[model samples]
Target: MGFSDGVIIVLGLALFEIISSIDNAVVNADVLLTMSERARKWFLFYGIIIAVFVVRGLLPLLIVWASSPGVGFMGALTATFSNDASVRDIIERQKPILLAGGGLYLVYLFFYWLFVEPKEYAFFFESHIHRKLSFWFYAVASALLLAVVWITIRINPFIAFGAVVGSTAFFITNGFKHNAEQAEKEIAHSKMTDISKILYLELLDTTFSIDGVLGAFAFTISVPLILLGNGLGAFVVRYVTIHGAKTVRKYRFLKNGAMYSIGSLGAIMLAEAMAVHIPVWTPTFITFIVVGLFFWLSARELKAEKIIA
Candidate 1:
């Protein structure tokens, strides 16, 4: 039970981590390309080390510990180390709150993309729906999720508190991340060292990771499995960041798949928060299914074009 099941859980968790972080990988790749070659190498090395060891490794432990209901931080830590069940018990109790916060953040991200400034970017959404704010459409998605969040809150006050906090944090973080991106753009033109760019990448990583780590609870609550799986996945995500731009270019639809995958993962988190039973493997297959459909359509379009030619 321990060995075989452990292996499956680990692999599943790793895939989830990869799926969740592709957008981050793409953004990181964009940043890395601007740096000098030597600096890029060192930055990636240290970035992976910190992202996995510090962020992926320790952060989950701290979350489980700190978020554990009644126990103080140190007490929770002691429980986590001494008794695994205690960690699981605490997390299970708080799962709704964690899920609510993570899901709302993702919903906010998706709506912000579609609604905030439609003219700046061309999205499929703008062609179909005409509006002043486009935010009303965002409401369609948010309203249902908010309803679920509200229901979850009645059962668990922690979940309500979490959702409110999550919404506020999302608003603040989005602006903060925007500023970071702007600062990065300015630095690209300045005499700043490659170190500056590297630091920016790491900070940028921290923001995305909040959702990734929190969403991880939907899969498994075991700290070692979470760390090992997420650590391995983070390593691959960094590799993908370094070499991913071309891949994304080659299959344009997959980029959309990555984005959709994020939004779907967020929804799943919220549903689970509301006591909806979803399988752990739901994310892995849903992503493949969405991207696969697009891949097939793209291929058919190419073949048809060739025939016409």
Candidate 2:
């Protein structure tokens, strides 16, 4: 895309991101109210920027890099076998940059998931897998699994098995210490102060941003465009949270519908990450339909509640 074309695409993406993120904002508002004003502001500023950076700027770079040569011959081999011209082109043109990008994302996901969802430590009387394993064991397991798949692509079964075992061991051995520290924090903050709650909500918003940003890249690569779309979407979500919270107090069904939308989006994102290509319109249509259905249902429920009173 040319400069002008890129500009237009970016603008459109911004608008799209804004619209998509409205539900996020609504969900955020529900949780944000539990946070202190400072925490809320921190989320509004720092959290949003981090989401845009990781999702829009960082992820594509990683994807492109992973498909490139030298960094990982396995990834290159896969791209070549897949017969995807776009992946091939990215490898040839942007391999080094992409490799660095991908490395960053891997690191980011490791820390993010670790801190976000720490696994509980168990002692004896555990399952076979748990009894002998440390946290790194699971990471090694995942690495081994990937290595097996990578090896299968090259008809090298032994190497694949070795790769999986090696990678799994490396990650598991190194992982979990951070998670252990985070677990302590969670325990100490069990009371869930307003600030803590707001921070939690902000992290939730960041999680929601991952898919939206990734999907936005399927349309355009310009960082500006992705940011624009995400920013607009987040704005709409914030608006909904403010207004919906007020109006939906009497209509529990509306809140339920909103929650359903959030849940569905989360599922859709997971599917997308796994290479499932549900059209963007699917979520867009569901958003409107659910909103309308909730409105109707909420009205009836509220009316019934009044009658009983």
Candidate 3:
């Protein structure tokens, strides 16, 4: 590529990565809100490295290795991403698993939030169905999830298998049984260990970035260049997450918006798993647009109350 062309690709990838990760920034910010200032800084620094290098960069390569057991790691790595067609094929073959895993994981966050703290919400919007249904909302979430898996199973049992694995992973790793227990255990997971939160953010980053490099493929297949350009965006998002955490700590509505974004991502993932193929950037843009509107509204409401008081 010419110098100008290379620069354009780098800039395009960075911009795309930043816009796509806004929801990720919001989610991480909320989790980091629970940590100490020092802890937050530490986690953000380490988390960004892990998220960019391990999650976005390395994990997909590992997936390439894992998916093709017969091939040597180096061979699988090269063949899988040797070009746009090769990379796209791998992603297509694994789409069911990726979507199933990512979608269920996202959905579980929303379910956990609702069951654990129904009163805490974002954007001042409540699902009438959720409110009226109350505890039965658990059943609703489950049935819907299972129904999606079942649909995928009919198309490809592997997809259903992936969905089950994703949901089970969330249940086990997230300490779900305890969260499901008496109300007192609520927020227990929110107070997760530094290590646990680190892992949480890492998984979110990995799943969030599964589709990320697809856009990068539009430009180049040189893994090092891909990492360099995308890593720039990764660093920026980490800073945003820290700043976002601080803002969320101050603004309850922003936290709620993050929760809704989590749920929306889950829905989008599930939809894609069912072969709906929503554009990757759709959720990312919609999330920020919706959140921005609510943030503005909440700011106005807060200012009005201040004046009245």
**Ten-residue segment with the worst summed lDDT in candidate 2?**
95-104
lDDT of 3 by residue, 259-296 (tens): 56567767776777688856534654655665676677
Candidate closest to the true structure, highest TM-score = 1
1 or 2: which has the higher TM-score?
Answer: 1
Cα lDDT tens digits, model 2, 266-303, are 34433333335666446555555765676777788779
Q: What is the alpha-carbon lDDT for the whole of candidate 3?
A: 0.62
Cα error, residue 177 of model 1, in Å, equals: 1.9
Runs in model 1 deviating more than 4 A are 1-9, 78-82, 116-126, 129-133, 137-146, 294-309
Cα lDDT for residue 172, candidate 2: 56
Q: Tell me the TM-score of model 2.
A: 0.41
Between prediction 1 and prediction 3, which has the larger lDDT? Answer: 1
lDDT of 1 by residue, 1-309 (tens): 268666766776677677667656766676677788998898778888999888887777777665564666775666556765765566668767777777777767666655553332225554445466565755765585577656876778788777776678777787777776566556556666788778877877776677667656656666677788888989888888887755644443444444455577778877887788987667556656765665665566556767999
Question: Could you tell me how far off, in angstroms, the CA of residue 39 lies in candidate 2 after the best superposition?
Answer: 3.0
**Local distance difference test scores for all models:** 0.69, 0.48, 0.62
Q: What lDDT score is found at residue 301 in candidate 1?
A: 56
